[model samples]
Target: MSKQYTPREMLEKLISFNTVSERSNLDLIHFVEDYLAGWGVGSILVPDETGKKASLHARIGPETDGGTVLSAHTDVVPVEGQNWSRDPFTAWEADGRLYGRGSADMKGFAATILAKVPDILKANLRKPVHIALSYDEEVGCFGAGPLVQDILSKGPRPDLVIVGEPTNMKVVTGHKGIAVLKTTIRGHPVHSSQLHRGVSAISAAAKLITWLDGKTAENRAGADPECPFEPPYTTLHSGTITGGQAHNITAQHCEFATDIRLLPEEDAESWIRDYRTFIETDVLPDMLAISQDCRIDVAELAYVPGLQEETDGEAEMLVRRLTGDNARNVVVYATEGGIFQHHGLSTVVCGPGSIDQAHQADEFIELVELDKCASFLDDLLEGMSQIDS
Candidate 1:
């Protein structure tokens, strides 16, 4: 018989694996694959090109259509700069909370699903329950696209996908989309005394960053008061910036990264086009005037589509019925739920823990949150068993 673990134990085991976004998650993936195999559940591994990382998916119960997909990502953010009291990868319980990296962000919910496997098997579900553990979700949701394709190609279409993304167990019907971009400016280097003769890459970068901030201010000013999002507006932000060799010299190179979060109703391409146009028409011309080699380049790092609210979405109704949470909610962060919904699968974001605790120094999920998530899964298993296929 496969060893049965409580949700807490599963969480501890998962936390032990340092599946940071920058590192390979294969060790954690292999562990999960073996655990699922112990339960006689076979997993399909979708490995990335490097073969160092992979996403795992498995089905419990009948291999029929209209199943529910419990989706969670295995990767967590880096803990390098955080002031953690203990090892971020070591799970510890204190003050009714489970502390560790990835605890609240997602691993808590993933642990709950794994711990419930025995009950899921016993439920003899009429409808299948799909478990989808994805990789690279923190950095860019890069793994989810391929995982979703693999799942849809292999089996009958899933009826709904519930993305466990630390929503305090509340059902989230929509979230903002994100477009990650990197901008690099190349300029002719010259002494600051002769600044007028050569373009300063750093100065150009500052102008572009100011433009991005201005765009954000414009959106904030025009934000919809009735919008469910906290800020209720699109946002543009520059997370990192690097360039300039010295104070006395006009910089030869400047580089920065920015991300734009758009409402589900907005078009991402339009924003990209607008930003590119600003660089080419408004910014780049001045640099080229100084030197023919002077240029600005903008590259897209990643793009995650927003989760749009579905009218009477089945996923929403099912989650509300299970958790009895009727409050309509939307989040500002992006999730793989958007990708699932984009591929014609009805999806919602609902999971244990608060997003506030995610990506923090002492990240934790309240013990009660884990219990509530377990109960939610229990209710789902019972319902799946009782419902007709």
Candidate 2:
């Protein structure tokens, strides 16, 4: 096989398979599996229950014990309405940057890892380098949960997991945890002329919105004394609200989505309970009295924990060293790192490119960034070699 597969070639192979979060990653997984199998490396294919989408966990050395893992999600968010300058599924590079739907968010890192495997294998270092490419990360951190649980169940989980989310190649020690909460409010619709006869769900939703605004304001006002993040403390936001047709109609239904980012001790569940209490006590009492059918319901769309790298985190320190940086940093976006840590693997978020370029039209990862990543991998190899078998 060719040495150091050109970034173009690696990215070409990656972008050919449309591994959108809503779709299957089988083609991409099969390609990687086939490519790795050729080198006598075995892979474990952990398909989702439906046997549609899949996440692959494969080892480069002895699978018996602890090792270093290079993980990246194979899924990309949908490119539905975005006006792309070119085909989003086809890899194209211009002015030293590769463009595609997942180029920076982040098939580039996955491709880079696969490209680096040859060099890692050739090094014959004491520690094994494992690859964990997952699916459905864009939708939520869903696919990785079960796959990692299986790994932990067998014991001796990987020593560290590097989640390659875009961070301009910086070693990210922390990010906010996210909870996607949806709330639906129900009431009765009647003629606008008979406004008194109708209970408006849109109006109820306004009450819920006010409640959320209060939470956001409280956080904004008294963000934190013990906050560990930038502009830290929990925040609540309602993104979309829809109901009511014509001005004449009293809207009967309103559904809105609210997302919250909580501090570790804040306990998102407790906040959810508090929000439920507000609805049960303040918002719903009047509506329920008029009609027993009126209600407000909340459900979780997804939940992923925050990444908090230890002060002396081995994984964070290693990544910072590998990147040739003297200091580690933090990011605002959540990633798959915390989940890996939750499942017993010391993990940090580090990868090539910038999130600024991620999920944007004509998303791209610059060639310079890919070059820096290759150099980091080289540094990682040298660093790993220092440890005795």
Candidate 3:
């Protein structure tokens, strides 16, 4: 807790907590809350309705908004299957890098912001530097809404928001949206001998999968002819599929899930509408002919919006000034930046480390990247101070 503690130390402290998306981030939240309290800052904790998780919002300057929000997620993705050289939480530093689960994926940025708090406090500020951290961001950006909603409903709107998703020290203003879906196939079971008479959900599900894959391919090919990305198109992919029992017998049930990575202009609901239309127009009628009870159901698992700022948007200008970057980049990954923009705050993504290292085995952030981020924060805080003064 000494002034000599660098952002990396604070990051190491943060990474030590196992705040997986499935677990409560309360411990991490409280730890951060206490840290800010020691620095004479007050925070608000919006605990989940079930009391399992919470999001923390703290301020170093004026409590009334209208300055900036430094936001990052508290939860890290699961590391169950990945092989690691060391404990994912212990935060080992070597080869000029900090290795840990959330090291690069996030916590590092939080630490950078934390390390600068003393400087921010010392500066003559006219506006607040709101520090907002949320849980379940990896799950779907769900936990941030309520916390941000409360902030919006209570006070002045922030001038800008910086979403600290790893971007290799570059200012990224745009990213693709993501949608997850789980589908169910329902039909009547019948005797194995009665192949034609029975409504085979397995067969219907295969047809649906084929149709979906085709739709995905069509969308990918036809979408955004002026694609800015490497693939430059929407991506649809099935993750899990299962059905049927006996080889000779007609199976009654099948279910599966898919993920849709959409372009900025693409609305996830549009994809849903098209899919439902396909199921009704092409799928249901044929199955209904065999049995009246035959049905297909689709459910949305999660939807993360795209951060599609216009060319040289307000967000772009703000980030450009902060990072001194003249070029903007777009990413395929989804982050809370999109959510923040949707909620009315001008948002931009710019942080430390390569996302390639994110959510992987031996995930780590290079010391050079952290140094760059710290320098970024230094300039940002100084800029805010000058404006506030």
Candidate 4:
């Protein structure tokens, strides 16, 4: 426990934790809680029902309206199949970059915020600065839902929220929303020769998948010119499909997973409703004709809302001032910025590093990126101090 811990040192510690989304992040959460406690900042822990992982939130300076929140996620994606030059969990500094899991995808930004704690604590501030950390962000943003609900219920609304997602320190005003779903088809298995006596789940599943592909094509064909996203349209894609065992035997069960990314103007629920209708009305009757026992089931795995630029310009103006960037970018990947916006906070995405470096085999953040982030924090703290004084 030292009074002076640099961002690089903190990142080295964070990267060593191996907080893959499938594993518990309690160790990392506890480490952060302990660090904040040493600086006299009390934090609230929002744990999952299993108590294996948790989110931490703390406020510095005066507890008042119009406070700003610095938000980040604690978990990193799994590195099981990727080949790395060195251990993904061990951080190293070379070639002007800090290489490790979570170094760029996000722990870098978290470390920068943590490094500013002492200065934030010492500053005279009319408004509070909140630190919000959550788990399982890399996997469908599951952990942030409860944590965001807790933050909203606990206090007055924050004036602005900066989601520390790697954007090369540029202000990102928008991103596409993501939805993950799984579909299972059940039918009767029978010999291929006696196909009429049974329903082939694999066949039905293929038809459904083809239908989904048509939807994808349709979406692509009807691209919105005004959309700022790269594709400029919503997208639907299937990730995995599994069914059937023997060549002669008909498949009794088939399941496939699908992902959808929608524009901010697109209604996710409505798209899902159309999908459900297709299953109930179009796909179900044919299966039932063969056997009443045949059925199809669809389940939602995850949903993250898209961030849309507000007309008020509060979030944009603040981020522009902080980063000195006049242009805004839109990313295809989803983040918790949308969640914060849904909860009534003017949110923006601006942080260190590049998105291309995220989720890669040898993930790394440039030391220069961390330096830029530190400078941003210094300027922000100084501005807050001046306003409070």
TM-score of decoy 1: 0.97
Quality of model 1 by C-alpha lDDT: 0.94
The sequence of per-residue lDDT tens digits that candidate 2 reaches over residues 266-376 is 567877898999998998999877778888889989888877757677787788777766654776667888788777678888888889988888999997888877788
Who is ahead in TM-score, 2 or 3? Answer: 3
After superposition on all C-alphas, the RMSD of every candidate to the true structure, in Å, is 1.5, 2.2, 1.9, 1.3
lDDT of 4 by residue, 273-324 (tens): 9888898998889889888999999999999999988886687887798888
Candidate 4 to native Cα RMSD, angstroms: 1.3
What is candidate 4's TM-score against the reference? 0.97
**Local distance difference test, candidate 3:** 0.84
lDDT tens digits, residue span 1-389, model 3: 43435888888989999999999888888888888878787789988888999998877776666788899999999999888978898999889999999999899898888888888888777787888899899988888888788768766667778988888778887899989998899876777787778887888888878887897788766767667765688877888988877776677788999988888678999888988899999989988998898889999989988988665467678778777787758898899888888887888998898899988999999989989988887777777775532
Q: Can you tell me which runs of candidate 4 are displaced by over 4 Å? A: 387-389
lDDT of 2: 0.82
> What Cα-based lDDT does every candidate model obtain?
0.94, 0.82, 0.84, 0.89
Q: Let me know the TM-score candidate 2 reaches against the reference structure.
A: 0.94
The better-scoring model by lDDT among 1 and 4 is 1
Per-candidate clash tally = 0, 0, 1, 0
Q: How close is every model to the real structure, measured as TM-score? A: 0.97, 0.94, 0.95, 0.97
lDDT of 3 at 46: 87
Ranking by lDDT: 1, 4, 3, 2
Candidate 1 on 27-103: residue-level lDDT in tens? 99999999999999999999999999999999998878988999999999999988999999999999999999999
The count of backbone overlaps in candidate 4 is 0
Clashing pairs in 3: 126-388
